[model samples]
Target: MTNEEFLSKMQDVLQTEEELKLDTVLDDLAEWDSLSVMATMAFLDKDFGVKTTMKDYKNVKTIGDIAQKAGL
Candidate 1:
């Protein structure tokens, strides 16, 4: 997917309205919780065929990190 599409999808995954840019910090968003992480995992797996576990989020600091994981 394109970076723009990835960012848009992440907004829905994260349930945030704060204009998610590639550099947006995941931890800074109020919607960035355990549930959001699970949603993200499911989204990535379903849309991009990228499997991820909870532990994988440990190093995820930015939206760009997720885009990388999604191979965007």
Candidate 2:
């Protein structure tokens, strides 16, 4: 997937349209909580067949990490 597609999917998963600035920190997002993490894990698995764990998330500092995992 392309970066735009990844960002769009992230917006859909988070249920937010707040502009996805590349430099934005994931933790700064109001929706970035454990639940959101779980949702993201599911989203990745369902969409990209990439299984991610909470432990794996510790290394994911930004939305870009997620895009990279999705192979964008």
TM-score of each: 0.96, 0.87
lDDT for each residue of candidate 2 in 4-69, tens digit (9 for 90 to 100): 777877888887768775566898888888888899999999999999999999988899888878
Instruction: Write the residue-wise lDDT of candidate 1 on 1-72 in tens digits.
Output: 788888998898888889999998988999999999999999999999999999999999999999999988
Off by over 4 Å in 2: none
Against the true structure, whose lDDT is highest? 1
- The alpha-carbon root-mean-square deviation between model 2 and the true structure, to one decimal in Å, is 1.3
- Please report the TM-score between candidate 2 and the true structure: 0.87
Alpha carbon lDDT of each predicted model: 0.92, 0.83
lDDT value for candidate 2?
Answer: 0.83
Candidate 1 has its poorest 10 consecutive residues by lDDT at 8-17
